[model samples]
Target: MRPRFVLPAAFSVAAILLLVSCNRGDLPGKKQLESEQVQASPVAPVASSKVVEELPGAAVSPLTVEQRLEDFDYMWKIIEENYPFLEVNKRLNGEDWLANKEEYRNKIAAVKTDDEFFRRMRFVLSRLNNGHTNFLSKEEYPWYLNTYVQAGFGYEPWINVFQQPNVLARYNQKPLAEQQSPNESNNDINSGEAGSQTGKTSGNVKKVIIEPDQIAYLGMRSFEGSLMEMDSSEIRDFLIEVKDYKTLILDIRGNGGGNSSYWRNNMVPLLINKPITYNTYSLYRGGEYAEAFMQARWLTGGLLPIANIKDEQMPNIPPEATTMFKDYNKNVDIVTPYQSVGFKGEIYLLVDSSVYSSAEGFAAFAKGTGFAMVVGGRTGGDGLGTDPLVAALPNSGYVFRFSLQMGLNSDGSCNEEVKTVPDVEVDPDTSKPLLDQPAIKKVLELAASQ
Candidate 1:
């Protein structure tokens, strides 16, 4: 059975006490938190550890190398036993699961410092191709960051306001408007050159066409890597140029989330006029009731501080660039509602099961504001809130992530267990053009009726 999401009895009481104190404005000072940290369980218990007797393949190594191999032999053992993914481990194998450790150990000595070990370890973990799995040491626990949490945006793009053209009443805004009426082209501003329209069935898009009359249709693939390091000018200019279209269709069908702040910054310009209240996230404990039941040791064991939340709001401390959290927070900039581009026209967003994490965040934000109409399959990931936590093992220093923060919708309801539902349900209709031109069709259909 799936591990039910619930905290123990004692933990509940402590959480309640802490929450009550905070609510009453009897905030616990740093000393109190420090004291709690000191008293908290440094280690959480898991199943018994199993030692692997032999390497998977007949690979011999030096004594130090062999010992390093053995150390990881134990490390993988502990993780498989304790990790939440029991079924996945069964398939990965009790022995071969240490493939990364062995591969790294075969290359470098295990006797190397923890820093060198983990640096190589992370590279190896990345090879696993599973975003959820990772390794971190307890010592490095304080500096770990699981979420692509952003602080805010550094630059805001400029937006232009233009009088929206009605094709039925104006006939000058339709596709081939230029070819149809030379008079309309004389005074009309050319926002951009009409590119050759490409039509096909790709991964998520059902059917879509690029043409002179259609607003620019954008498809964002994966959301990973560094945004601050990349140039945003091109992206900004692209969105600005597309603004001349009657309606923009943004498709995020298979977007497995990356850095939240990155999307926030990129999408801020598209969100016109006012800042809408985005969804809220909280830790996923069983709420007030579960808080009353959790034990002290379990409550603090492997527990981490979530970045920010509505209730357990993270306070701004002194900047520490050394920590990933601090660095990310400092680099992140939120797009204030009032500072957004107020696009006067309609916007359409499409999503599907592959849409997750930050993609869901983007969809959720767009959904909350009524700025865009979502049309496609429902999102696979939760729409409401997320408990963001990070932790490391004590002995091997293997880093890992857990759903620490639970998320809430704009209405403050729990959505962790429930994935985001679509406004308009759709399946990938491959017989048609890949990009679903439902938005364009809707507009065209409405225009034809008039």
Candidate 2:
């Protein structure tokens, strides 16, 4: 018998979104919601033994040639062992990664200063062309921390980017007469305005209101926080507060994704009415790592003793062995409504190039299921890979992260190769705020009609 696995609550939301396999937790029945609220697990802090220190005026120590080479080799080895999209990457970029590795390896030997070494390492990782695969040096990681504090992490940046004048101008340029065609029935008067009424929900959800229309807007800058951290009850209440509106505009523009479970357990359930099959299938690359993962489960009490090899289906290897194409198989997932009752209102989803990883997955799912009308630009196309495993260099303390599996679309398409196209395509003007854009007005008009 294949041992039944229960989804653990300890996993980070980021990990949960990146690794779909990890989200196979048992779903609570409808009655469960009436009985009590689902409690979220606390997120554990990542522990590192070697603390990176900062010196204001201390002498800068440059990495020696040997240390640089060692760090480069270690980073390269981690990717070689685990990166799941080597074949897809090659096909997309038309570059021989292995050959480039040798070329870059030679270049790394000549890099002198720590700055040069870090830059070179980043350049090498950029060859993968994968947003999830990256190198974060100890010196640079602090910038992220400082920036998050100053700009409110992901939220402020999204607001600043989408609210630019140039961005709003692009939307405003759409012919008002064209928008008011005979086929359109909504009594939407062109406001000719370019700003949104912004507020924060009790849950801290950034709410935007376009004037003259009751359309409710919510922006998901990232899926980073735990469901509890996000205040699920507040979110539910906010939805309830806006449930009477004609439409709900979900703006995920520039959302670089964090955790799928947050949306899955909290947002998704509230939006959906009936049980729907969102994820048709997921493909996993089977190899020594797969077997090792399975074995480790047994030793770690994650698998039952009765589990046998016959239950394990071998992966079908592709013809390109050098490209790391191993056996691939599919898995399915089904989503049901969270509460016995749900929001029956129309939903509009806003997407853009920065909408990546789990956000991309959510967009794909929402679009595939006809759950919402996706508007704006194509998604970032970074959701097709599995969760990344983080590794630190022995000498420089630079961290390398890479995916172990590749996720496929509902139709067995690679999301990394093909972006999720919107139902209504709108070219955003980067110079303006998203609220000021004409697309928001169009979406509002459509929502009013619905």
Candidate 3:
């Protein structure tokens, strides 16, 4: 445990003076602020932010000096070079991680054991408050308990404990899984900690007939597997059946992401006759991770934005950060190779906070191109980039993973920050059971209106 030291009362006056000379035109951070008038301040303001900085966790065992300086330095270099969400997290969560480089290094230098280093690294990631990135020291560090599969089952116990608590909630500040209601197929898939394996190969789209042929519904429980890979005619026949429906509601409320290829091959070819496109943008440092990701995806085109994307919520790209652009015309449009029957009627995507990764990517594609009317709640983002990149500490050999790409939309807003917004916002009626899916009624009403 790190000791908390309150400065003497007399030192408060001096601390205020120094802070005012420093802090300029910035919003108040997570610290408790008391408004006060400052004297002899010209260039800067906001004197009351004389913060009692909370220290990160300490090692349990006593260890040698200079324990892991090189290992930490290597990690810091990678983060500095590639990570794009640093500024976004700072503005949103009030965590200026780059400013506290030495503080984290000092914590790593005194780590008594390998376990302590892992814990300390997790604390470092906690400061970022990101769901896509994490220090994967434990095999199941990200497991969640998703009980929303059925009617009687309620929320998992840990939902009240860790997921999206107050930013300054000390040790509880890590970006825990934003777990929510899951499909029966995704009950074990999302609730990974409970040791239920709803892996890709088995889970398929469940069909629900809302109003016979007039209004149809399909529950895309998880994008973990391909409709083509299962060697089944069920998904194929279902798509062929609903391809001509007047209005189709694709429910992805509890769909946790798996593979981009799942829908890329299955849904896009069969449903999207006219190409659905969005201006895709990416930020990267041309590191090994970026090279491999681009090459693996066979990404072939890019150009700089007309102006350096200036958004208040977006990251202020450093001089070293290169903006990579993707042409949605070629990438998202798949017609010549795979002939699309294309759903002629209106397609409405049903989403909630639980819709994430490739699942959220589907919602984004639908929303971005006006292919589907996005209904229900806003989606979980961090969906536009490739899978996370992994690296190992040279000395300790402890491996971890983090996101290297910061995907953006056409309007220069970050997908990770803005997420996928609904065209028709309908809040889920939490009073009802999870299995009831109360939001669908309003979504259907709104869809018919439009």
RMSD (Å) of each candidate, 1 decimal: 22.0, 17.9, 17.5
Deviation in angstroms for 301 in model 3?
Answer: 7.0
Which residue runs of candidate 2 sit more than 4 Å off their true CA positions?
1-16, 19-67, 139-204, 209-214, 226-228, 280-323, 384-386, 394-397, 429-435
Task: Report lDDT (Cα) of residue 153, candidate 2.
Answer: 22
Clashing residue pair totals per candidate (backbone < 3 A): 49, 20, 0
lDDT of 3 by residue, 1-450 (tens): 001111232112110000000101122223311121111101111114473322222322323445467778877777776677787776667778889899888877777765566566656655655555554322122222121112111222223322323211322234433333344334333233232222333445677777767777877666543232441244556777777778887777766665555555556556765444354556655555445434533442443342444432335333223343212211232222134556688888888776766677777778877877888888777677654554555544444456666766655466667778899888844456433666677756765786
* Model 3 vs. true fold: TM: 0.64
Backbone clashes in candidate 3 total 0
Give the better candidate number (1 or 2) by TM-score: 2
Q: After superposition, how far is residue 205 of candidate 1 from its true place, in Å?
A: 14
> On a 0 to 100 scale, what is the lDDT of residue 421 in model 2?
88
Best by lDDT: 2
Question: Which parts of model 1 have CA positions greater than 4 angstroms off?
Answer: 1-214, 225-231, 284-342, 382-388, 429-432, 435-450
Give lDDT tens digits, candidate 1, residues 1-450: 111111232112111110000000112233553232211111111123452211111121223445445555554554433332232223332323444454555644634554444444444443322233444333222111111111112101000000112211111122332233322332111111111012211122222335555556666654332321231333454566665566667777666654444355455544566534433433333233223222321443433443343233333221221121210111111235322455565677877766666667667767766767777766644332222223333333244433323344545433333356666665623235553445345534433443
